[model samples]
Target: MNTLAHGFADGPGPGPWILFVPLMWALVVGGGLFLLRRAGWRGRAPWQQGRAALGEQSPIVVLGRRFAAGEID
Candidate 1:
């Protein structure tokens, strides 16, 4: 019976380098997401910046704008 055929081989199965492939992919995807979010945040118009920073406006403020625009009686 041949030793190689009988499952007596002596060599490294996968080695530590195989782990780097998924790690590199995760870093690349995470970095791309971070850059996209940063770009989107910076791309907002100047007028929109204050509203975004302040979160949702109050209902009274919304009514005031509508009244000022003559959209409300």
Candidate 2:
């Protein structure tokens, strides 16, 4: 009975080795980041300061609309 069932079914396939694909990728990415950090690579370029300063009002279009709607301080 068991021997007949084995003939008609798929065998247990590719065990845990398939998991190594993502594992290797994770290690590679982690290693690259580690090397970059050791080599003084700070990830992204610093953002340039924008022309707008803190505590500034919105553009004239927005201010005009707000004043017309009585929504401004």
Candidate 3:
């Protein structure tokens, strides 16, 4: 009684390996975005007092000075 009606056709196909391709792509893209953000750290960060020569204050410090000058309150 070798019948295809009740045979291997009912068995499960390949398993979780099919999910790896998109997972790898997502990891690669996420790491790329992280590095891109990290690369901009120098430009966005304020120059420290120890590092500044001409006395370049950070954006936050500049804002504080303006506030002290009655710009905000």
Clashes of each: 0, 0, 0
| TM-score to native of every candidate shown | 0.40, 0.42, 0.39
- lDDT tens readout by residue for model 1, 1-73: 3333333345545455567779999999999989978877676676766765555475668888899999999
- Per residue, candidate 3 scores C-alpha lDDT tens digits across 1-73 of 4343333554554345556778999999999888977877444445453445545565667888899899887
Model 2, C-alpha of 3: deviation from truth (Å): 22
Tell me each candidate's RMSD, in Å, in order: 8.2, 11.9, 8.8
Q: Which ten residues in a row have the lowest lDDT in candidate 3?
A: 1-10
Please provide, for model 2 over 1-73, each residue's C-alpha lDDT reduced to its tens digit, 9 standing for 90 to 100.
3443243345644555566778999999999999988977776553323325522444765788788899996
Please name the candidate that would achieve the greatest lDDT relative to the true structure: 1
After superposition, candidate 2 runs with Cα above 4 Å error: 1-10, 44-73
lDDT accuracy of residue 64 in candidate 2: 82
* Local accuracy by lDDT, each model: 0.70, 0.65, 0.66
Worst 10 residues of 1 by lDDT: 1-10
